[model samples]
Target: MSLSLEGKHALIAGGSGEMGYHAARALAAAGCNITLMARGSEGLTTAATRLINEVDGDVLTVTADLNNRLSIERAVDHAEESLGPIDILVHAVREDVNGYYDQLDVARLQMAAQTLLIGAANLVAAVVPPMQEAGDGRVMFVIGQDAIRGRPLGLGTCALQHGLLGLMRGLAREVAESGVAVNAVVAGLVDTDRLSVEIDQIVAHTRRDRSAVKSDLANGNAQRRLIQPSEIGATLVWLAQDEAKGLCGQAMVIDGGELG
Candidate 1:
């Protein structure tokens, strides 16, 4: 089936990052009005301009830190003010994670909870109510292996992913009658510039060579290669389209069948 998403408006959080940027580009090509939100204005401007040149849609940029709920709410309002009510909301934002679970402490947990898990809730709250009035909406969170299975050395992250999954599941039920669908896209070992950090964590945990760790992850998938960011973007695009209205409250895994 073809995805023709014209006349929709989308707000992509963390729109300057690889996953978010690619998703924005895909959404723009699908003919939706695009609002790219990120903490820094530099990359957002670059991404918005590049996307504008590539697709026949409006690309707007908003700069705000996700850790700030007020700022997140303000950005949501700004996007709606400029682009109209957001019919699609994709959250591709994440915080930098390093070190092992044993090293975690109260301060770190609180920060992660506030910046990531709680921040996501704030954004969703700000974006969804208006959707109920409009009678159609799609909300998607881009998560990783940490959410589904426990990360060996990244337990703290695993916890947050679990929290996000819980939030999505709960929201999915609450908004079902409102004609809104809430779901997640679970990706694993995707080929992004940030993969180096994941490799580092694996190496530090397994005491293995960087090359060995990288190859192991790449070959872990049935496809024998790292999943591309564009693949994730494509999945997000599909889920937001009208044809996918029946798929609600689900985690569509895009990990090349890594977990059977």
Candidate 2:
């Protein structure tokens, strides 16, 4: 019943983004040392400072590209060297693609694959082995709801999202006996900076009021509101705990009942 993560270390792959920031916040608050790995040093530093001010643990930032395998390996090594073994690995990446099926080309597809699938594989390869040797670890992916159901004009995005789910499930079974629980947090429309830009675009196209557009989008879900980043953060923290050991190979959907 305990959820204390004291003395643990967590590496958040997309730690500069909204979801990643919140996840790192929650994990750090739960007493986990945090290593935020992302491509941008400025954003990573900003995020690390925010975490340092808000939580109790060493906050380290590593600048690395998710599209490159060697970059991911080196970043993980740096984090482990700084904070010791990573007890939890969170892949909260955001790869934006023009998902129109007709507009999709090999380049776009490769970009998506490299970011979502191949980069994830590289990260797992880098961290999971040491976790297995230590006999305990938590691996989580923060992904979108498109992985479960398709949306119009988002074929490429949905395919990559589902591919991540497939990877999580397959790897969960493979590492079941290794004492490493692998799962994913399937998120819905969250009220983040990214969503604000999207809402602004809708406003510009429709010439509608910003609040009205937000309301209409919120009504897509039964909750009639957008999900908060902190909620997803809480979920990631919970899944990283020992209590969630049995919740492996599953997509913990946090869509405010939107999927229904």
Candidate 3:
């Protein structure tokens, strides 16, 4: 499959974070014009600049709070205006409230649902019109391992994650005739700068050795190591390619082999 994405325009929500940042770099390197959207301008600017320095693309930033519908609407409009119609859309946003299911509050649950599920639906709605008209579009969602198998880690996130599968499937069916594809990339133990800090916190809180913490993080995966953000980024790039037309409504697991 030809992976060349030359001239494609990509709108990435939560593009300033680890997953989004590398996806932007991968897409840009693959020849897609890039736009990064995040809640903060500082990270957006830094991410855009880094992408520009690393790859050739017209990189831009859009600041919007994902939980706010109006803010999202404006950001989508601005992103489309900045880079033209979005040929590729990557929703890499994540909202996690960790705790036992019973310990979570109703309001926090709602917020997580809005950010991961409703927010994604709204973004896709905004970008799909142009795609449907153009008869071509690729949408990829960055999801967590929690979406794949049930674990105690993110009891609060199961609803959002599972709902995402349903949302993507429905959207995929809706846009199939229009030559658009929607899918999720389920990632596990992604090794990022954020993960490094997280490892530190785990060791301090649990009074476990660094090695043990790292081991537990990779325990469910066969590879027993963290996945790189770029690996997921590259996977997103591949999913957006013309060769991936048949992949709609699918969840591409990038975890290093989940344990049975």
Candidate 4:
């Protein structure tokens, strides 16, 4: 079945990054009017320009800090004013401050919580009311595989994903009767520029061969290959379409069998 989102308005948070940028492109290809929100105007403008060049659709870029509630409200409002009412919301925001439990600092932990959990919750709260009134909308969060299987050194990240899942479940139930679906896409180790940088750091810290470390990371998955950001973006586009109406409150894991 074709999942066409023609005429749909989509608002994507963190849309300047790899995953979010790909997601925006996919949605635009599926015929949705797209608005991407990020912290700075420069990255957002660049991403928006790329999408506009790639797809025959309207694309808007907004600068707003996800960590700030007021900023999020203004961003959403601005998007609505520019692109009509939002029919889809995709949150691909991530704050990856890697540290072990003993080494984790309070300020960093608080920032993590604010960005991942609180920011997502605020965005949901801002959009859900109008969506429910209209009796149609799709809200999706981008989670990680480490969320399914708990991580020792990645405790902060896992906590954030878990909290987001809980929030999604509650919102899904609350809006079920109104026909608004809320869900999450659980991602695996993706081969993005950011991940490449992270792998470099890991190799330096562990004093292991880059190839060996990459092999070890892939060994966690049956595919033995890192996922591409566009693959996740395709899945998000599918989930946001009208045909995915039955998929509410589900944390759909796309981990390439890594967690298993």
Name the 10 consecutive residues with the lowest summed lDDT in model 1.
Answer: 94-103
* Backbone-clash count (model 3): 0
lDDT of 2 at 249: 97
lDDT for residue 99 in candidate 1, whole number 0-100? 60
**Model 4 agreement with the true structure over 117-148: per-residue lDDT tens digits:** 88888888887889999989999888777567
Q: After superposition, how far is residue 110 of candidate 1 from its true place, in Å?
A: 1.9
Clashing pairs in 2: none
What does candidate 3's lDDT look like per residue over 1-260, in tens digits? 57899999998888988889988899998899998999899989888888888999799899887667788889888888888888998988877666666777779888889788878877877778889999999988888777867766457777677778788889998898999999989988798776777677567656999988887887867887789888998999999988888998999999888774
Candidate closest to the true structure, highest TM-score: 4
* Candidate 2 off by > 4 Å: 201-210
Q: Comparing candidate 1 with candidate 2, which one achieves the higher lDDT?
A: 2
lDDT of 2 by residue, 84-122 (tens): 999999999877554357767768778878888988888
lDDT of 1 by residue, 22-110 (tens): 88888888788999998889999888888888889888899877767788788888888898889999988776455676677657767
- Assess every candidate by TM-score: 0.93, 0.93, 0.92, 0.95
Candidate 1 — what's its lDDT?
0.85
For candidate 2, the C-alpha RMSD (Å) to the true structure equals: 1.8
Which parts of model 4 have CA positions greater than 4 angstroms off? Answer: none
